[model samples]
Target: MSNTPQKPVIGISCGDLNGIGLELIIKTFSDSRLLELCTPVIFASNKVVNFYRKSITEINFNYQSTKEYNRLNNKQVNVFNCWEEEVAVNPGQLEDAAGKYAVLSLQTAVAALKQQQIDGLVTAPIHKKNIQSPDFNFPGHTPYLKSFFEAKDVVMMMCAGSFRVALVTEHVPVKDIAKYITKENIVSKLHIVHKSLQRDFGIDKPRIAVLGLNPHAGDEGLIGNEEETIIKPAIKEAKNSNMLVVGPFSADAFFARKHYDKFDAVLAMYHDQGLIPFKALASGDGVNYTAGLPVVRTSPDHGVAFDIAGKDKADASSFLTAIYECIDIIQQRADYDLNRSNPLKKINPEVFARMEDEDIRE
Candidate 1:
């Protein structure tokens, strides 16, 4: 095996075929600059690609089909052709077929990811409701990936430039959100966010700010006691564990004055609390990254737009940003591993031991 480190091989899945999944992928790969960053591989079949190409007016990109990673064309995009069945393509429609094929593509790409065939995965938007099946019963990609990697906890972190926000409770109904905001859950998510910054984003010591669930941060137990009873204690515990975490800050003021810029990442109490501000700050151009996964997985911040699926009005900017974010994360993780393996390789063990003994004797 050649020991040379080349461009990363990025695996992509066609999410909710009836949505704008394929359109975003096609538009992202059309830019030759992305190809220079990483080798692109779409797990969908030729039929799927052709359908989208025909539906859309103008897009230019060629692909070479391959079942294995070694045969991937570095210059051209590669299509793995996970499914060869003849299925009707209906853009802007939510049907069972779309969900089935979406799950198939995701399963195929995840297998490749586990085998180390691809460096990372950038999933297009999948309709949460239609994509539910026996094989995929999770709420969203974050939870499914958490189960696949067997990670204890994973945070759905949205990123744009230096501003990042992670969710404490994702994909849960508003009524049930309060029940999940226990101290244990908050502490676990904070640790994940802290470690992810140090490992994935190359922050040596990450300082994280956490958001409160209630307005005005529960007004110091007057409005709601979750912040004082749950969130504050969780932050204290995380700090005791040597993590640089702070806040039970009111969600309103935190984002209002651009306070998120001061920290490495923010931990929001729920989905809308984190995502609403993130989307506003990013101007609908951000990437959703699954933090604490053994393998890298990111997606566009937006969802599958069935309304504008076939109208060619889908924006590919977020998808392109996701591709770049995956590439950067893969490289950062490798570097983190390299540095973590040994910090004193240049120092002799015998000499260090002798010095310790001398110090003890003195």
Candidate 2:
């Protein structure tokens, strides 16, 4: 067998064909340096790729049409044509056909992931409204991927540089967020975030900061009792279980004073609580990563910009970051698993004996 480590094959799901999905993919892949990192397979039709190439920038990359992922070419972009049916390509238009094809592309890519044909998936933005179907009845990709992978729980963690954030309640209405902030939900999410930090991000002893649901952490129960009843108990339980978790911190001061830098990750109570600060801090370079999934998945922390679909005004920085994040996470998970299975057992016999006895006694 060759000694060279095989590069990961990242599946790129073509989002709404009418939006800026293909545009971002094409632009990001235009840089030849990216090819050296991992092979990319766009889960879209050759016709759609050609349509976007002609409409957008004059990129010099070529794609090979392949029916099976095993035939993927490492030198060129691979277009795993999901369907051959002719479809309209109206940039910036939101129609049922665009939604239909988007789902088809995602479903095909997800199947490939389950088969291990692709090492990771970097999804493009899909329009939430028109993409609804019997198969994809969820509100967004996070939940869809959660159910697809059959993961017990997943965290919608957003990352950009030093700042990392995961939400407890995502895509739920503001009015209903309080209802979802129960003790069980908070504890489950905390465990997911903590485990993902160690396994996926390579943090050996992860330090997670949990944000309070109410402003000022309910000002000590004057604003709300969630901090006292739900969040505080969860934090206590996590710490007692030997997890390096802290806080019920006030959301405002947490980010305002740059306190997020003190920890490996932050667990915000709701969508806006986490994302508002993450987006503001990350600018346009944030990547949304689904934690606790058996398969790796990342997406640009952005939505399909229907207005700028064909104008080439869409920024590819976030998409590029998502690709890099997926590759890094894949490598990290590999290292984590290897370390776990073959841990360094070089401790002295006496020290090892003592540790074992302590564990047994406990």
* The candidate that achieves the highest lDDT relative to the unseen native structure: 2
Q: What is the lDDT of residue 261 in candidate 2?
A: 93
Over the stretch 1-362, how does candidate 2's per-residue lDDT look in tens digits? 11122588899999999999999999999888888999999999999999888876567767789988678998888999899989999999989999999999999999998988889999999998999988789888889989988888888999997579999999998999999998888889889988988888877788999999998999999998999999999999999878998999999999999999999999998999999989999989999999989889999999999988889788999999999999998888886776576454345657657877778523
Runs with alpha carbons beyond 4 Å of true place in candidate 1 = 1-5, 344-362
Clashing residue pair totals per candidate (backbone < 3 A): 0, 0
lDDT of 2: 0.89
In model 2, pairs of residues that clash are none
**C-alpha RMSD values across all candidates:** 4.8, 5.1
Candidate 1 on 246-338: residue-level lDDT in tens? 898989999999898899899999989998889988987799999989888999999888889988899899999999899899888876775
lDDT of each: 0.88, 0.89
Where does candidate 1 clash, by residue pair?
Answer: none
Residue 122 accuracy (lDDT) in model 1: 97
